[model samples]
Structure formats: structure tokens, C-alpha cells
Target: MEFREAIKIALQSLWANKLRSVLTLLGVVIGVGSVIAVVTLVNGANVYVAEKIYRYGADVFTVSKQPRVISSYDEYRKFQKRKIIRLEDYQFVLEHCHRCQAVGALQSSTGKVVSGTHSTTDTDIRGWTASMPPMYNLNVILGRSFTPTEEEHNSHVAIIGTDIQDNVLGGNDPLGQEIRVDGVPYTVIGVGEKQGKSFGASQDNWVAVPITAYQRSYGTSKTITVYAKAGSTGEPLNAAVEEVRTLMRSERHNRPGEEDDFNLDTNDSFVGLWNQIAGGFEAVAVAIAGVSLVVGGIVIMNIMLVSVTERTREIGVRKALGAKRSDVMLQFLIESATLSLVGGVFGVIGGIGVAQGVTAALGFPSSLAVWSIFAGLFVATAVGLFFGVYPARKAAMLDPIVALRSEL
Candidate 1:
């Protein structure tokens, strides 16, 4: 028999037992669907993290009093023992780091901002140096940044985030308007561009002010985080980090051979942390999906065995009419593969719908990769071929005389 004839026979056989075929395909459907859905979510999360959390420009690194990732209470206590980063340390790095093109400092606090009867609660208020806007890509969409003189004299000028403008000021022209932040009045000199959402939370819910002004209002006791940018045409980021580290260690009076008390983080560090987290999730998801596929393959094998037994007389008739063993084997293999392929097609559609539903319901971003769909289909087909082999061989090896005499 030709391969096409075998395929036609296989399809006819499946069609004749439609309910059984559907039942046998349940495993493949679930396995492929789960794999595709998990992959889509993980891929989308990676993209979101890269664009939002790790959006710092190349050649920039931040210096702070403690590590960003602390695993235990002991570690947290150790970090707490480290001296708080002071404004003098920021000034020292600015004057001493020749490889750096720009240096800035930031201190953050949370407070309520009131504009007339409107107010925003628990809004982030950042105190930053004049160079912070360019260093951190904090673009101004309306009005102008406060002048250096304003920063020097602790001027009560403020830059509001998009959320503050829309929620607290009711979308009015906030430029030159006075808003009270934690009871201190500040003139809105600029409005920052919208930063969208991250991790299901709004990023544009804050106000920015000069670090000097922040100190006057919020006090000088807050820990400062220093930012430095490498020169465009000069030293590499590693060299710049090391330079800052050496300067900080000296200023903090760290003895030689002792571990430095501060932490330095770059954009790559954030990416690495995200990779560690995302990698773990991917591994667990794949393991669960693998179990489902394996169970589905077992079911297909059992069902195919039953199918061969029930069709013994039909097989005997086909062999009596000159059907070769290879022809019989090929026909069974095609049936198994067709079943799995059908299941895979349904699984892909289901997975896409699930991903979309999750994104819409939770407001989380999800992106489907075309390669994941193709990979899922291919794996499902392979599972069918692998599990179908034993049943197909048994059917091909059956004795024609015995099979013809057997009951249906």
C-alpha cells in the first residue's frame, strides 16, 4: 500500500471511533497547552523586566549602603551595621572620579501631596541632584528642570510624575503651580514623562525635588544613593566601578583586606538577578509539562494496543489481500501521529487564549513567541511516534490465520 493510502486508512479508523480518539488525545492537549502558556508568560516577563526595571543607560552604576539582595536576617543586620551613605560621600565621588562623566545623588521618601482638595496618598518623593535627569533618563515632558542655583540654595521647586499630575492635580497645567508635599509647599517646575507600569504597579506615582531641598524638608538623616556615568569616550564601566569602590572604601575608612561595606550595582546586575528568578520558574514549568506529556504518551500507547486487538479481523483481511507488514505498521503510526497532531493544534489555540485571558484579567503583559507554537506541535508529533511503535509492531507481526479466526 502507498503511504497516502495508509494515511487515508488511519484517518478513517480514527473517524470511526471518534470518541475514543478524543479521549486518547487529552494528555497531549494538556501538555502542549501548559508548555506554551508558561513559555509565553516567562518570555513576556523577561521583556518587561528588560525594558522597565533594567532601563538604566549603559555605563551607569549606582552605589548604595547595602546590597539589593539580602537573603537572611543576619545579612540584613550586617547591612544595617554599615554606615549610611552620606552627602559628603557623593560629593567626594564627584570630585575624585575622573573617569566618570556625571555624578548624582538620590534620596527617596513617601508622603501625601495635596493640591486644593485633591490629594495622593503614599506617593514616592525623590530628592535628586541636578544631573539625575540626564544620568537616569528622567525626561521632562512639560516645563523645565530646576536650575543648578535652585538646587544649590535648597529651592522649594518640584517635578511631578505623570500620576501626580493626573491624580492629584486633575490633569491641569501643573507647571508653576504650588502643591504641598508632606505639608511643605513646592512649586511644580517640571512634569516628568509617563513611565507606565511595572509588576502591576504604576511607575509614575511620585514627585522629584533637588536633593538639597529634600534634606531641608525631610532631614539629612536619610541614606543617599550615588549615581555615576562613565565618560562616553573614556574609561570602561568596570574601571569606573572599581574607581568609585576604591574611593568609597578609602573615605569610609575600610582597612586593607577587609570587605567593603557598600554595594555597587550596574544594569547587568539587575538583569542577572532577573535571569536567576525567571530561570527557576521556567524549569519548574517545563518539569510539570513533561510529566503531563509522558502520561499522555502512555495513554496513547495503551489505547493503540486496544485498537489493534479490536481490529484483528480487519487486519487479517487486509493482510490476506496482500497488505505488507510495513504497510500495516505505517498505517498505525499515521493514526497515532494524526491524533497527537490534532491535539497539538487545539492545545496551541487554547494556550493562546489562556495567555490572552490572563493578560486582560490581571493587566499583566503576555507575548506569544511563534517558535513556541511550532516547538509544541513538533514535540506532540514526536510523542505519538515514540509511543505508537510497540502497538504498530505488534499489529504488523500478527499471524493472519490466527487473526482471521479471532472474534471481533
Candidate 2:
């Protein structure tokens, strides 16, 4: 028999048993769908994470009360026990770190803000020096930032975030308006440019004021957070970090091997931590998806075995009509493969829909890569071939006379 004829027969057989074929494909559908969903989510999360990291700039590093990433709850608890980053340390880095392009100190706390007839329930209030805007690459959309002299004098003038502008300032211009912070009134000297969001945070909606003002008004203490922007080239970042470390050690008057009081962090360190988390999630998802695929493959194998048994007399008829054993095997294999491929096609579409729906509903980024689709399809086809081989072989190896004699 011609290969085309054998394929037609195989397809007709599958179509005739629609319910069985559908059931047999379910495992494949589930497996492929799961794989696609996971890959989409992971890819999306990676893109989001990368964007968030790059926002901080490659040349930027920070020294604060704690490191950027912590692996475990125990480690986080240990970090919480560490001393806060102090104003003196920030001053030391600014004065001594030559490799650093700029250094700034900041502190933040949540407080209520009131203006006229309106009030905000709670808002993030940050205190920083004149160097902060440049280090963080923040641009003022309107008005001017507080000057270095204002920081020195602990001026009460403030910069309002976008959200605050809409809430407190209303339709009126925010610049030169007075807003109350924790009951103290301050003039809004500037409005920050909309910086969008990253890492699930609204970077645009954060208010910045003078560090000295923050300390005195809120009793924020001398503890501060410091970020350093390294030079544009070479290992300046590393050198800058070392310089900050040495300077801090000398300022604190620490001896050799003594634990440093403050922590330093970088974007690379945060990325590494994020990957470790993503990797664990991927492993778990793969394991669960693997189980579904295995179940689907077993179903395919069982269905194929049943097909072989049901077609015993038909097989005999074909063999007697000059169909070779190889032809018999090829036909069965093709039938199984066709069923799996059909399942995979539907599965890919379903998975993509599911991923898209999730992204839309949850406001999460979910990207479907070309490679994921290819991988899903390839696996589905492979499952059909792998699981169908045994049943196909069994059908092919049967004696024509014995097959003809079988009652089914």
C-alpha cells in the first residue's frame, strides 16, 4: 500500500472514534499548556526584573542598613539586627571616595499629609541632599529642587510626588504651595517628573526633601541611606565600593576582621538573588508539568494498544492485501502522532490564552517566546511517537493468519 493511502486509513480510523481520540489527547493538552504557561510567566517576570534592575544604572551602588537581597527568613532576621547607615558614614564616603561620581544620603518614613480641605491618609516622605536627584537620575518636571544651602539649613521647603500633587495640590500649581507633613507646613518648591514604575513599585510617587529637614522635623535620627554613582568606565564601581568600605572602617575606627556596621549592595547582587528565586519556581513548575505529560503519554499508549486490538481482523485483511509489516507499523504510528499533534496545537492556543488572561487580570507582564511554542509542539509530537511505538510494533508483528482468526 502507498504511504498516502495508509495515512488516510489511519486518519479515518481516528475520526471514527472521536471520543476516544479526544480523551487520549487530554494528557498532551494539559502538559503542553502547563509548560507554555510557566515559560510565559517566567519570561515576563525576567523582563520585568531586568528592567527594574537597569533602572538603577550599572554604575550605581548603595550602602545602607542592609544588603539588597536576602536568601532566607533567617538571613533577613540577621540583617534586621545590623546597625543603621549613619550620617557620618555618608559624609565619609562623600569626602574620601574619589572613584565615586557622586554620593547622597537619604531617609524615609510614612506620614500623613494635609493640605487645605484635603488630606492624604499616608504617604512616603523621603529626606535627601541636593546630590540625590543627579545620583538617581531624577528630573524635575516643574519648579526647582532644594539647593545645597537649603539642605545645610534644614529648610522646610519640599518636593511633591505626582500622586501627592493630584491629591493635595489638586488643580492648583504645586510649586510654591504649602502642604503639611506630619502636621508641619512646608512650601512645595518642585514637582518630580513622572518616572513610571519598576519592580512593582511606583518610583514616580515618592516625595523628596532635605535630609537635615527630615531628621529635625520627624526626629528621624542621624541614620541615613546612601547611594553612590560610580565613574563611567572600568572597575570604578568596585574601586568605589572598596574606597567607601575603607573610609567607613576608618571613620568607625574598626580593627582587622571586625564586622562592618553598615551594608553595601549592587544591582548585580540583586539580580543574582532574583535568579535563584526564579530557578526554584521553574524547577517546581517543570516537575508538575512533567507528571501531566507522563499521564498523557500513558493514555496515548493505552489508547493505541486498544486500537491495535480492535483493528486485528482489519490488520489481517491489509496484510493479506500485500501490506507489509512496516506499512502496518507506520500507519499506527502516524495515527498516534496525528492525535498528539492535534492536541498540541489546541494546547498551545489554550495556554497562550490562559497566559494572556492572567497577565491582563493581574497586571503582570507575560510574554510568550517563539522558542516556547516550538518546544511545546516538539514535545507533544515526540510524546505521540514515543508512546505509540510499542502498540504499533505489536500490531505489525502479528501473524496474518492468527490476526484473521482473532474475534474482536
- Best-matching candidate per lDDT: 1
List the pairs of residues colliding in candidate 1.
Answer: none
Q: Which pairs of residues collide in model 2?
A: none
Scanning candidate 1 in windows of ten residues, the lowest lDDT window is 49-58
Candidate 1 per-residue lDDT, tens place, 212-330, comes to: 98999988886999999885423588889999999999999999999999999887787789889888998899889988888889999998899899899989999999988998898
RMSD of 2: 3.0
Q: How far in Å is the alpha carbon of 226 misplaced in model 1? A: 1.3
- Report the lDDT of model 2 for residue 188: 91
What TM-score fits each model?
0.92, 0.87
Prediction 2 TM-score vs. true: 0.87
List candidate 2 stretches off by more than 4 Å. 1-19, 171-173, 193-204, 405-408
